[model samples]
Target: MRSVWPLVLPVCSALLSANLSAQPTETTPATSAPEMPTEAMNSCLQASIPSAAATMTVAELRQGCQLLYEQQLQSAGESELQEQQVSSEDSTGDKGERLLKRRMTLEALNRANRFMLTPHKINYFFPASYTRTPNESPYRDNDNESLSDLSKAEADFQLSIKILLREDIFGDNGHLYLGYTNHSLWQLYSDADSAPFRETNHQPELILSFTNDWEFLGFRNVLNDVILNHQSNGQGGLLSRSWNRVMLNSVFERGNFAFALNPWYRLPESAQEYPGDPDGDDNPDITDYMGKFEFNAAYQRKDDIYSVMLRNALDGDNRGALELGWSFPISSNLRGQLKYFKGYGHSLIDYNVDLEVFALGIVFTDLF
Candidate 1:
């Protein structure tokens, strides 16, 4: 029965082959017919697979109808990796730009601080003339002996340190100044035989000042200043003096000319002594209120270095003084100035100490 079954299977296979060969011998040409249009093909495929139809393009529908196939392929490939790399580089570049801007701002602030903290150098000259009678006598004697008739010259070289405090510490446009001065002078001349004859005068002074620019009467720019000064000499002939002064100054400007008026008052610290009798032995006390008014006119040039000041003082004795000064830079750290002053007064000439006096001096300054 097994042998018969095997022979039956072979006959069946032959029969099937014979039937297929006899049924379809029809021959078709290579260009049998034009292929269906892409839209028609896609419509036919979409009808067969309705879910794919909604998203299908004609070419993709004809080729393959798979969900997320292209997207998955792209994600696994270099295109997606390249996009991510580019996004990362852009983020890093943005961060770098922010950091660069921050660094530049810091650098600019540091440079400005360097300029603001820089130090300054200053120099100044202080020359004062004092005249008093040789004796307590108010009138000139027949002997023609008076300390006021005697001429003396004293000058000081001062180096100042300037610092900017609050502009509003005292008031708007106000400034504070602190200064120390070392001074030495030659007595020039003294009459030991005469009463109250002076040997020499020398001393040091410490000064503090506050100054302001204020408007007066709504039209005038007035300079209001206050000064506290302390002067001392170890010598017994002259006593220590401490006083404060308040001054009001006004300036008028016209073309290249400037005029200034200053009125000031000095408060006494203590009683001051003067020479009384001959042999330089007797001394008398002189204490009183002192006030002074000064008028000045100046011609200024563009250089601001060369100018002449015609100054007159109105006090107990009317006096006129002329001052000529010149300023120039000597070096980066040093500066120089030359000044001259001449004055005459009845009190200064007849009753007081000095008559006609001249002074010459130079100064050097440095900044750090």
Candidate 2:
């Protein structure tokens, strides 16, 4: 592997650029060239053709791969000219429909910069959130304020968005963006507390996504992301919880079904000098419960979407989380949502605590 990258980097560069639109070339008469063959090798050669690299040098693979990419590009463009088709994933059918819409159509090839802010994740709000167990350990720890009375029902919401910063920074495909997401839990029913915010987690991230149209088993793997993420619940001493991660995400879709793989390596933090110390890791064992990998899947039927998400630490303790959800159309942009969660990682403050929650809410959008 060490020797492989250097040897294939130049060849791979030529395949999609495989960042991977082909370089522009002069067109000749149809008789001038023999069309190169690409037998539905859907993605760029770099990702799907490592085995082939063993036998060829960059010079040998460049010409053939580029020609195949060109043909695929030509055919895809032609297909788009036929009767327009709509994707179930973009149920709202709004303009600038992103991610999935981009995946299901050739519009993704139009990588020209029409920079705009877009939703990063599913934005949702739950008005009747009921949790059986409220982790009060953090509030009881030294240096933290005490909270004697708590409510079993409250409100929860999350807002997430991203903006394109640049396109094709490296080659023809890498698009960069800045993103932020905030999740808040409110004691809406606690009149004595004046509807205080019980917990709030803020996430700010830098994202680099490599766009592609790779196909396998009727699924198109459309998005690849490399992210630098920082998440924290702003607080002092024992209530403080924060961590950083380098995460990789790969997203795939086929018809109304979509799936994603999310995995991350937590950046190391210094050990706290003492409990409640502010200048060190707020939650060093975060990975044990939040897990290093997560799998998410969703399927849509008409106006309804069924989804499930799983996270696992893959260690002896078997810590992590599971969530199941159903979202149905309530309006053009708003959808009714019902969700249940068990285990950990519901929020930064609850990352180590096991709890069960059932919530009814409205989501601004669906995951697909």
Candidate 3:
């Protein structure tokens, strides 16, 4: 049995070797690797693309990846800078709003003490007045030649202006101001001699004002001002008129109505060297008719304004003056005015002279 087994194994091995030798011998090339998962493929690309030189150079892939990353970083930086600029502009707008609020509050509290020369009263121009008095004309009357034949116009006109100097002086409740005002009577309609200025009165004043917050007798005190005032007509010979005074003014308000009381004491001036001279007190008895105190009252109803001024000696001598005025808006900053002045002292030249004047004009400013 052992001899038969060895002979059979030898025969099997010989047969297997003969069969393998009889078969053809050929080579088969390798195929590509199988696809990986999506995420794994991306990571593999990142890791292997830089080193896979047959597909692309590792250095070129690295440079492209760096450029892409740099572009992304630059876009992010620009977005961040734009956001910061918007934030800065918002901060500036907030600051401006706060500043505006503060300024508005200040104005509400102290409107009168604001700096700059704002107008205090109506400044206007008149084309004419009815009555014309040339009693104390600057032109002289001589025996040889009477100047009464001088060419004079019956119609007259006037102009006035006021300016301020200081505010909030000494304290927050006080103000100091200087003002110059002029009134001119022009004979515009008189064709003879081409019409000239018949009279021009110059008035200048210094005033110290204080806020008064007193309420009594149904009247609330609004302002109190002390004034050093001078008025003159710069004329020679018979037409000169001038005066100086220290005056006190008290203003009160109630609802839409306001009132002012002003009392003045005339300062003594040297008598003229000669009679009817230009440089001295032209009218010594001027106060007898002009009075010691004046009263002014004003009322406002919607867009309409009315005012009245009165002056009297209280002596029953039937002396003093009265003026009534009404104003209504004609435009945004302009108003049409109707004024009636029947009194003495309409001008320094007319201080001792009585006249009735009615005028229509535009008002650039208002008292209230």
Candidate 4:
């Protein structure tokens, strides 16, 4: 593959250079010539023809080009006629009408020029945010004074291959997303103070969606969604794991109100060996089952998006939890979110062990 890239690079570069070189010729027909049809152009356009007998006759080719050129001229004449009519209608109007007519003419010229010259565009955004926690939870029991002291900041970076696939194949609404995230605490605590806690996580998921605009069963926007996720914990084996999930979600929207319910299941790696115990004798291998339901509503249109969620599990025992969050878009490409979670669950832990946790964190997202 390494050797192939070097060979492939020049071929692609040459192709692009040829395409760029042809743009001027396509846009500007030589004034010195009579614009007569040529056999070379015909051959280039009809290279798929197996033989000269199958190619367009000289007379036919000439007639085709003449027809096309005449059609373009006729279209230009029609546009000029339309403009004249508009100017005549505005002649008896006020200054605003004259300005509007001038603007319309300029817009028409710009549109024509754009059709002749293809252009490319690029956009970029950056994200940064801070969070502060007021209470200590089981998941964040360190001596950190504020939430910012425990999980000081969050950052996200994302890039998307726009419209990588058409909407029809998967449905009318689908997105291809690629992203990376980083989270960390303030540099004041020792290793023991943050021991066994995850400092950073990396996630990337692809989503396919289908939706109906109208609400059914009192639901506003109804959507069917499927997601595949891969995640990694920056910690050691105890925290490092990856899983894949499939989900179906429905959303309802009416006026400024909206809500959603998401049901999902995850398949995790084989738990043949428990983390931190080489003997694998501490806990029995358990199958993991997961589900989630979420609701969201808009408010203030800025810095005040609120949402609530319920998550459940039955891997070894029954466990259920609830979460609430607020999120706001900081920029067209970035958003900041703060969320709080509380869980009552013996299922997430070993059957012999009981655990409870309350956690709060902030998330920053870069969307494309």
Candidate 5:
């Protein structure tokens, strides 16, 4: 599956779009509008106008025609709304159709290779990330006496992206995708230590995506994803941390709010005969802290977004994590992020250690 079209798809997402309201005009009154193209008018224009050596841009031409259409509609004292606008909600309160269709269009573009790569997760960097608990036992276990001091403050960032492998690979349902995500922690403030990267986790996944419309108690199920996932820290011996899992991701959306539930099962590996054994399970008790499932919710209020994540180990130890985040628009193309985390599994190297973290940064891509 990884070799299929350079490997693309990864997981789940459903996009949101706002309704358009007409701007106040000098002569005409308007209420609301949706982006719609006039097929007949476009066909007529193409037949009449000279195609070769075109001087006018498509936007200019479209704007002129749209103005004419609006004037005609206003003359009849009626408002025209698009019948196919995904933003339109039903009176029964069964929403998510809008978001569902929008996602379908995005996936269609991916299949067409027009937008092959898409954001799989929130991409952000915090140069001044502070963690109250820094795991130093690994360094101590390494016996590298020269590196004893581990800073509590560091820089952290994550990059996650996916590409479409094939749309309708199952003839109608499954859309295959390959995704890669990278997480890294850097000791940028430790200038005395030359600012080396402390740990980096690499994840590459295969996803089978399906569009769904199931609803229960006013909530709409918009997406379902079956994923094969592998993550590793690219280390050896006692420092090695790696695991593989089969995961299920189900996403739901209602109005400007979205939610996701992800559960995974770890694949078992052989136990080690002794410490630092080469061919044995690394971090065999990782699940005891990282948990078996995660839940995420995001709510968008105009240009600002608020999100929260929760996880529980579902065992006697009852270990897990909680992360809260806020993203506000800084400019037309920029957004600022503030995040707080209290829990375990901030990084693979510190899976067993609990920490409280606060970070402020800028976001390149965000959760929708």
Candidate 6:
């Protein structure tokens, strides 16, 4: 790592030299606010080291400081900032006004009522794909029509979005969020059919989160979220698939790593009335594949971030899913993401179907 001491010493010496040889300014009225450091260098120094000029006069900055004073002030400011892991407050305007403005700005930025989590940012269009369409469809059995009669094309696309409903309704620590995610397998290359959505799944969930910062078990406690989730394909009859669940999630962090554990209980559904019924609780054995709990772990390595998700039934029958993801910087506010999935529960329709999928897309936010 480059040492700032070399660069800082010379610069500080020059500034001290200049300050010791500068002239004083005329005194102003007692009620008038003093002029602040406004030059690029002065502003930067003040921002990085607020105490460096806490009691310095304009004349001192311009012509009165010696090497010893500058060194002491710089060391003190740097030590405090490093210990707190926070930047020094900006020094501008009158003391009271500046402090008030800073407080207001910080509150606005962190208000719990305001939108905290991002809603819809990850959406991508792909020109190639593969998939096994559902053998039975609700629309076909109910209406005596083929809902997915078309053949799978060589190219397809998918779209999804999420929304935040409420944040910190009770206080600064509690949050309520509503999210929706949709996935579609489109036959984009089928000119004869005009690109119909071969398979579409809709997922909506309501989640309540409570956050606290502390250290436990060598890890930092991040947040806890309780979720009521519903997922289904907007289909009916033999092809219908849907489920509801109540889940508990806990998140933790340690240095460059973030980890989460999610456990859920499936809400019971009314059974179909008759033996031939095709509707109620479509996939009763879904838990056999989807599992009751999942774990997510993410780590940052330099500019790239990697994440892994794992789920297991924990019963004698071995079944679950595993997903691996990597995200790298693509721009200032955007990141390119690549994901690979193996096993079941990739989607509601594929809850019981073993499948493998690889996806490349852009993510607007980092898990960090």
Per-prediction backbone clash count: 9, 4, 0, 7, 5, 4
- State the displacement of the C-alpha of residue 60, model 2, in Å, after optimal TM-score superposition: 33
TM-score to true structure, per model: 0.38, 0.71, 0.63, 0.41, 0.76, 0.61
Ranking the candidates on lDDT from highest down gives: 5, 2, 3, 6, 4, 1
lDDT of 2 by residue, 244-322 (tens): 8888888776755667788888878788889767777888888999999888887655456788889999999999999
Best by the lDDT measure: 5
In terms of TM-score, which candidate is stronger, 1 or 4? 4
Once fitted onto the true fold, the runs of candidate 3 whose alpha carbons sit more than 4 angstroms away are 1-116, 132-166
Residue-level lDDT tens digits of model 6 in 1-368: 00010000000000100101111122321222122234643643443333222333444333222222333343444311100111223111122222222222222222332333333213444454444553334334455343445444333233433333555566555656565556676656665556666567666666675665677886666567777767677666556677777877776666546677788888877687653355467778989999988888766554566878898999998899998878776654456677777888766666887877776665543443
lDDT of 5 by residue, 7-80 (tens): 11222344422211122222333235543356955863464244211333465445434444444454454674
lDDT (0 to 1) per candidate: 0.31, 0.63, 0.52, 0.32, 0.67, 0.51
Lowest lDDT 10-residue stretch of candidate 6: 5-14
Candidate 1 lDDT over residue span 1-368, tens digit each: 00000000000000100000000111311111124456765564554343332223455444332212222333344221111112333322222222222222222222222233211122444344333322223223334344335434344344323222323343333433332333333234434224332322221222222222344443223233333333222233222212333444444333334345555554333233343222232112111212244555533232224434443444455455555555454432233556655553212112123233333344343110
Question: Against the hidden true structure, what lDDT does model 1 obtain?
Answer: 0.31
Q: Lowest summed lDDT over 10 consecutive residues: which window, candidate 3?
A: 1-10
lDDT of 3 by residue, 1-368 (tens): 00000000000000100000000112322122222345654564475442332323444444333323333433444211110112333322222222222222222222333242434334666554555554444344322123333333344333332333455566555556565566777657655445666668766677676656678897667567787777777765556677777888777666556677788887876677787765566778778888878888766554566888898766767678999988776654456778888888877766766778787776665543
lDDT of 2 at 313: 99
Alpha-carbon lDDT of model 6: 0.51
Model 4 pairs in collision: 133-147, 219-252, 220-252, 220-253, 221-251, 221-252, 221-253
For candidate 1, the C-alpha RMSD (Å) to the true structure equals 43.1
